[model samples]
Target: MSSPTTYHLVRPHVVTEIPTLDEHQQQVVDHAGGPLLVLAGPGTGKTTTLVEAIVRRIDDGAPPTRCWR
Candidate 1:
């Protein structure tokens, strides 16, 4: 005979909040208008940095239509 496994149910709220970017990430986000390249392994926040930069520029009055990925 096999015994049944016990499971514990945890609420989603138990998880901690997302972390903020580090200094390197902040630098990437603060770059001015010009050509830029991000080279790193997967899960290294490349996309996140670019997204933040775009949003920051837009928030600072850069036209959304003029921005490119």
Candidate 2:
């Protein structure tokens, strides 16, 4: 007779620091609806603002799959 093998699953603990948004970035992050166009030069935190907005939506009960990229 052979003994069954035991398997264990472990999830890694990740720590992420959220950045503070400036006035304009905060505006974009807080926009409720309608088409929003963000025009800015490179290194202007555009991606950061977009990501924060998406995270905010998800935190507000928006589904991950339905969240805008």
Best-performing candidate as measured by lDDT? 2
What's the true lDDT of residue 32 in model 1? Answer: 72
- Which residue runs does candidate 2 get wrong by more than 4 Å? 1-15
What range of 10 consecutive residues in model 1 has the weakest lDDT sum? 11-20
TM-score of predicted structure 2: 0.73
Per-residue lDDT of candidate 2, residues 16-45 (tens digit):
799999999999989998899989999999
1-67, model 1: which lDDT tens digit per residue?
8989999888776775444878988888887757877778999988877778787888888899866
State model 2's lDDT. Answer: 0.91
At residue 46, candidate 1 shows an lDDT of 84
> Runs in model 1 with CA error above 4 Å?
1-19
- Taking all chains together, each candidate's TM-score versus the true structure is 0.62, 0.73
lDDT of each: 0.78, 0.91
